[model samples]
Target: MHYCQSCETPVAMEPRNGHAVCPECGRADDVAAPGPLFVVTGASGSGKTAVLAGLARRLQGRCVTFDADLLMDAAGALSGSRPIDWPAFRDAWLAVAHGVAQSGMPTVLLGPFIPTHLQELPARRWIGDIHFIVLDCPDELRRARINARPPWRSRDIEEQVEFGQWLRRNIADRVDTSSELQKTPRRPSPHGSTAI
Candidate 1:
């Protein structure tokens, strides 16, 4: 069974115009194939950046790693307030991912992304197997971590902690980094299907 690169749903073996089309999203698998795209997402101060950095160091030159915030900042898509411009952020991110994929490298994207934010990405049609991994921590620990950062905003930290709790409850693959750090990042299997 082949999975849709866009929505990660299992598509029938039947091919359309030489490509397996995702029935749910109507995205052709070939067009959406950007190798393997792993999104490591979590709330603010969730240790995602640290985890990705460790993974990159372990992988040596095998993969490409990028932070979504830096990408957004470079594109001027992020603001200092609530309600982000998702469409613009998605576009800019996809452009960078596409470039990385075109270079024949797997991508590890670290960011603060809810499930819905990923589902609504316009460039999903051109993305390959998208794996989502959410890092979680206790509220107190998260608060402490956020507070340790310079120029921290209390409101933003509170919001992030709340969202982190919600994400730990809602997301399927969650790693609790409160006590121990994950030494290695695992590559997602090509098997199984899920609705976007």
Candidate 2:
């Protein structure tokens, strides 16, 4: 039997409307399909890139990193010389990520975004339940990691650290990356239900 890609609840042979409704949360799993998308957002040097890289390697899937900056570049006019459009950038990020999830591959998105980016998406798109993994840690430690990175790495660790802290405070259920926190969540139940 087929199943909901997001939560794994069994689905009828002909699931309605190309959408998979999760029997557990009453939430639509993925409107399109499953790609095991994991979004890891954090200030630079929060170890998100490293952690996601490790996860990608371990999973044996080609790690795809979708930086919204690319979208900004695609729309250089709106993105401007600074590459900062919080609202538009966030919208684009959610769209690309949701599509990636539908592609049925493993994906890891690293960015600096607030929780509302996902929380505010339209539920009908069934864009909800995209695994959000926030990377957080003491600002100082994060700063150190950033400084240790190659010259190409971000140098404004303080600003990013501030943002990360703000997100960590505002968002509920962020797995702390300060130390060695597990990245992957336990698998959902057979019927596509989350215990939480």
Candidate 3:
């Protein structure tokens, strides 16, 4: 058994591509370093997925996009008061993000994430740079969007909306999506402006 240098967790010593790999985190000692990561965070109705889809199209061939929800196993959390298994979610997200970054492509991650979530990832040490952007939409507009997609739990929507408000007040980079709802999805500039 070997211990991962990054996570300090015991891992099976599996050799792959002439390097010892960590089974749990898929960390290889000899792999090329990863590229910078740009994380786009927003609440449920804040248009995170749409924004990321547009970004992926605009940055085609130069970047890859991943939805954090797909990396997480939230079934347990959904039935409880908490909505995520922070440790498990963090580990899974880091593994995939690190692997994608190692391929030399910038990664765009979309999810309901806060800055603190990024800090908990084990891959933080290896990542080159991280750019965080929070998508914002007005409460009324957000509620309308959520309502249109019926069958959603009221409590969940309220929680997400509250989080979105908190993000707008605290996060440095925020892009308002209220206007985007009226027009086509455009590329967002690095400085947090929606480009035409």
Q: Kindly list the per-residue Cα lDDT of model 2 for residues 1-196, writing each as its tens digit.
A: 2345545555433224556555654555435553445566776655554464466556565646654344544555665577555665566665565576566655566666655665664421434445666777887777766665555334776677778788787766576676673343322122221100
User: What's the true lDDT of residue 175 in model 1?
Assistant: 86
- Candidate 2 clashing pairs, residues 3+ apart or interchain: 7-192, 8-192, 9-191, 9-192
Question: What TM-score, over all chains together, does every model reach?
Answer: 0.67, 0.55, 0.70
On residues 71-124, what C-alpha lDDT tens digit does candidate 3 reach at each position? 333534453776555666655665666678667787888877777777766656
Candidates sorted on TM-score, descending: 3, 1, 2
Candidate achieving higher lDDT, 1 or 3? 3
Model 1: residue 183 alpha-carbon error in angstroms: 14
Alpha-carbon shift of residue 120 in model 2 (angstroms): 3.7
Q: What's the candidate order when arranged by decreasing lDDT?
A: 3, 1, 2
TM-score of 1: 0.67
- Model 2 CA lDDT for position 112: 65
Where model 1 places Cα greater than 4 Å from the true spot, the runs are: 1-33, 77-84, 152-155, 181-196
